[model samples]
Target: NAGVTQTPKFRVLKTGQSMTLLCAQDMNHEYMYWYRQDPGMGLRLIHYSVGEGTTAKGEVPDGYNVSRLKKQNFLLGLESAAPSQTSVYFCASSYYLLDTQLRKLFFGSGTQLSVL
Candidate 1:
């Protein structure tokens, strides 16, 4: 089974072009997240959803939006892409374990986006 999958493994865009990155999971997780990785920084959360039909902005939400229409899919959209937005994007999913009080995230391969 695919734990998590991301579409368009690589992409290049002009300054104002737009794109949407799709993430799908077969694990039936309750939480999903979108993160971006830059050259010298760790992954930063962009957006997340607790369950289907519910979404919330994450640490770096500007210029981006997300939707969780189905339990197994999450979509991240960049309306007007910018150079500063160029980065490696990763999608992850997890469920909280009540007994352990912890959640282990399962990450997608990643989507590399470049905006000129």
Candidate 2:
């Protein structure tokens, strides 16, 4: 999509292997987030960035790392892939509306990752 794009729509990784998920947004949003979708846990935040060069941990930051070197790009890295890490990952960007005191998120198509 034009708003957000995630590379490698699907992937299969072996235990102990490493990989990185790339997220790019063209909307010029102020906030970017990385989330993983599990069966019953729903969407769990992995990491987020409020702006360029700023990164923060979220609900589930363990086993993952993130970096926001540019305003339009956010990267999620897994040093060691595991079965528990297998899930559908989503990248989203949002912009705040001062007048309405609200924000809207634009999500990527999602990446399906399987750790064997």
Candidate 3:
């Protein structure tokens, strides 16, 4: 029962509208990330946080913002939604593995957003 959960699996927005997508986890992960999946771009990172109260921009952070106010939750917000922002948003969390020297991510089902 402990995993990532994203609310409002789908949404439709008008131009200039705004909304926030919530991502929560009970796994006590140290790192959390927000990514957008496009037709052929794969998953491009929008933002991420290493720990609570810290955030950083990732590959594509222009039209989106993210925050990690709690260790178990990460929020992605759109100030003014645009058509170009329509895509499948995903949330992931992971902890560093000493043996593998890599972080394994657990992702949410994803929220599909469309702007018209």
Candidate 4:
């Protein structure tokens, strides 16, 4: 079973172009997240969902939107891509974080997005 997978592993966009990155997992976990990693920096959360039908904003959600319509998939959309939004996007999931072994976050390789 795939833990977490991100689509459009690499992408290039003109400033103001729109794109949506897809994330999917088959683990049936209750938590999923979107994070972007700028070069040489730590991952910053963009959006997250604790379970299906519920989405929440995170540290950097300004240029992105997310949805979790099913238990297995989460999507991150950039309505208008910008040079500053150019970064590697990673999606993660786990059963829990507060008190569980599976609390260890699992990450996708990430989508390398570039905006010109």
Candidate 4 segments whose C-alpha is farther than 4 A from its true place: 97-102
TM-score of 4: 0.93
Residue 44 shift from truth in candidate 2, angstroms:
1.0
Expressed as tens digits, the lDDT of each residue in 20-46 for candidate 4 is 999998888889999999868898999
* Angstrom error at residue 86, model 3: 0.5
lDDT per prediction? 0.96, 0.95, 0.95, 0.92
Q: Give the lDDT ranking, best first.
A: 1, 2, 3, 4
Writing each residue's lDDT as its tens digit, candidate 1 over 7-88 gives: 9999999988889999999999999999999988999999999999999999999999899999999999999999999899
Q: List the residue pairs that clash in candidate 3.
A: none
| Stretches of candidate 2 exceeding 4 Å from the true structure | none
Give candidate 2's TM-score. 0.96
- lDDT (tens digit, per residue) of candidate 3 on 2-47: 6999977999999999999999999999999999999989999999
lDDT, residue 56, candidate 3: 97
Candidate 4 local Cα displacement, residue 49, angstroms: 0.4
Instruction: Enumerate clash totals for all models, in the order shown.
Output: 0, 0, 0, 0
